[model samples]
Target: MPPGVPLSPPPPSALANPESLTRRSHRFQPKSIWPVAILAMFVMLAIVGIKAYRSLSQNPAQSEQTVEQEARLPVRVTRAETGLAQKWVFDDGIVWPVKRRVLTFQAEGDIQAIAKINGRDLRAGDVVTKGQVLATIDSRRQRSAIDTANADVEVAVQQRNQAQATVVQAQASLDRAKSDLELAKTELVRYQELFDQGVISESDRDVYLNQVDQAEAALRSAEQDVRSAEDGVRSAEAQITAAQARVTETNVDLEDTQLVAPIDGVVAYINIREGEYWDAQRLNSGSDQDLIESAPIILVNPQDIEVEIEIQADEANEIDPGQLTYVVLEEDVSAAQAAGASNQDLLEIAQDNGSRGTVFSVSPTQTPGSRGTQVSIRGFSSAQNLR
Candidate 1:
């Protein structure tokens, strides 16, 4: 120990007194102060977090209430109860003809006349009546043929007359032959009697018998000639009949050279013009080739028109031919006008007033590009006026 340093009391020996050293270290160190400070900080933070969460939760309701107060304003509305038929439906469609006909020619020839012009305005779709000359063909050749046939018929008539005269001559010749045979038989009998009485020579009697045989052969030959003449007359008569029939046929052909309308209708189409060669029964060139054989040369549509619709098979079964129905032309007519009107009103007004129509028809096949059935609505021109 240094002088002047009063040796502090000898330091306690931790090895000898471990418990005393521990107590001294413990007294100098803080035991619970740090734990208490940390706990207080945690409590302060918890309180602050609770207060913030409550304020955030209540803010949305306060903002919503303020907005609702500001939004209270004024508005206006209109009221009208328009009547509508509940049973009606609407479908799209196109207008088409109810009845149509076509015209054509019977014989091959050049067309000389055309009474109806293309695009000609017609009244009531009226058409030319049967036998009405629609066009004429160049009939020079046909006329010549008819003349030839007529001449042949005249010649046949003359020949038939000649045949009849021959038949009469044959009858006369047959009568004469019979008389000659009778006379020869009587002469032969007389000669035989003379020979038996010995009033004539035997050679003379034989000569008389020979004369009788010759006369009989001549009569037989005349009778055969008459029969041949009669056969000739029959043949001439048959020729006359055939000639007459040919004349009749040629006349018919000549008449056919004139093209005529077989029905009465408005000319809807015209395929030929005056001076145009309309070769009948031949395929037309260019655009006219599509004409059907039974088609008329002119197309005439009847006054009546009908609408067709394609509907699904299932829905179509519910419709009957005469079933009553209404149509709503939503796009064509105003809703106000259509409301409260009967189904018949749509049709009647359409016809008389040219109003848009609201009459409908149902069909049996599904409409294209649609999932359900199709229906057609008919409208009169009058109905179109109810726009």
Candidate 2:
């Protein structure tokens, strides 16, 4: 009976608020949320599975890569082969050539000419051969003197020839005089025999005797002429000899005007140039060192370059002729100075600078007043940094 009365109509409030009814309906059916939760759970599981699969897929390669990287250590490698083992000795030294010469003019004059190379005037560092005429002073005066001497010699020679002709003429006259004297004597003797036999008169015999006397006088005169001619010839010969000597002297003077190189070498220094005056007496007046320093030309054999070093006796003992050597450069010297250099450092410096050489000579004994010895290193001049 009550349900039949309630069934009159649904309430307006309940009808107006449909959301409440829906909420009420949802409250009674809680099982509906499980499908969405299950879907979300499945989505999360898929994400987890994808991540796990990716991690599993990359781990083996990464692990292998890491293992490979960790297995190796950084190192350098080189081929094993036989080679020369070098021992280095460190030192500071002075470099010079073994064969050096200082050349100067022997006569005083203005320089008229100088050697040339590559179309340029000869300068320091130019190579030259033995007997090269490096320069020549003005030789006009010497040439003039030589010309005068030659003229004198020619004149003297002519005099000698004239004197020789005169001697020949005198000899011919002497021969004729001898024949005349012999004829006169024979005639005189024949005339005397005739007179003794009373076949000739006294006057004829007397005339023949007189002829003989005259002939003797002529012979004496001819002999004197011959002697005078010989004397004149001798005088002419002496004058010729003296004139020739003068010619020789002038030739030597002319030669003195030129500067010649005595050996094959490079020009180390040149003080004279064309048109400059050179004075032998003045240039040669200074001490040897000064002379060398101021000499007109200086030459050095590049292949015979040498370096002189003063090192401790103990250090020098390790060096000998034919041992390898090297030169420390200025830059290397600075670095060495900063680091208190060792032999190894010096070796590295020399190798980098390319100044390689060999020991040429070592003093046999220590220096007189110190425990040091002198050592010489030989190298080519092309080793630019060797000094």
Candidate 3:
């Protein structure tokens, strides 16, 4: 009567009755070639045959009934799954420039003048390029020194010229004296010849010889004067060289007066105002006190920024380079915490609005006078991100 109940095949004697088979077909003529009873019997036969084969193939210890009972047993179910892991670190930090420098003077002087660019006086917050002068030191003294040196060099050059002229005059005098000496010798020889022929007195011969001696003495004096003149020329030349060296030094000092920007950046500070002296000696005290006394006169930096974070040592250990980070303002974080936001909620909020960064570096040791380790986070500024 049930849809899936099993039935058996008919005996061979029932199949042998051809007239009975025809009667069965006619009994369900509206259904099909076979009567409903015979069709039911065929379906039942297929089911029974499959069960018989299953029973034969099954192990003796594992019956069909036992397998069915085990499958029917109830199981206590629960939901369980795995998902991606993430860790969030919450902290506060101060913002900083990604790259920056503090400008200081090497040579000390009074801040006499500051550079002007395109008719504008350079000051803090002004953008500058490499080699662009920032400010000028007092160079009035240097200029004066240079002038004095130039005058000294000119005087030396004049003296050298005068000594050279003196040498020339001495040489001319020496030449005249040589000619006189030759004439005197010739006269003396003539006198000696006349004396031999009794044509002149011995006193006349003595006069010519005395004249020759005077001419020779004058020649020696002229030669000595020439050497002295040459020495004067050389001394003057040496003085000129010394004066020229002084001029070079003054020029270098003048160049140092102009404080040029070493790199392209904004002028973040100017410690010395006009007329303020930057003492080179203050830096030599070998103490921290001098650091402020001789600190940089200017500070400069790029637009990219960073933040320094102080986090618990345990949490800091988990952090590594390239790990994702977010920097929310300290005030904002405090406010969020005061409002009772959950850590998860706070993280979600920061992720949405805070600047994205990464763990750029982590301090190997804890910060001085601080228990927590310091971490450096670098990120693009909000303004840059908008672009």
Q: Give Cα-based local distance difference scores for all models.
A: 0.62, 0.82, 0.75
Score every model by TM-score: 0.52, 0.58, 0.49
Q: Count the backbone clashes (under 3 Å) in each candidate.
A: 30, 0, 0
Instruction: Give candidates' CA RMSD values in order.
Output: 30.2, 25.4, 15.1
> What would you estimate as the lDDT of candidate 3?
0.75
Tens-digit per-residue lDDT, 1-387, candidate 1? 345643233244843897876788857632434456778999999999998888777879797997798778655677976653333334554344455455566677777665654565222344667577666677888788888877887887787788778778877877887787788788889988999999998888888688778877878877787787778778777877888788788877777776566656566555565666666445443332255332335554545444545545665666665554433345433443558656456555434444333335665456456656655545434333222
Candidate 2 C-alpha lDDT tens digits along 294-346:
78998988666777888888777777798776676666667776889765666
Better of 1 and 2 by lDDT: 2
Candidate 1 residue-wise lDDT at 186: 88
**Where in model 1 is the C-alpha error above 4 Å?**
1-101, 116-127, 280-289, 292-296, 299-387
What range of 10 consecutive residues in model 1 has the weakest lDDT sum? 378-387
Per-residue error (Å), model 3, residue 367 = 18
How well does candidate 3 score on lDDT at residue 375?
Answer: 93
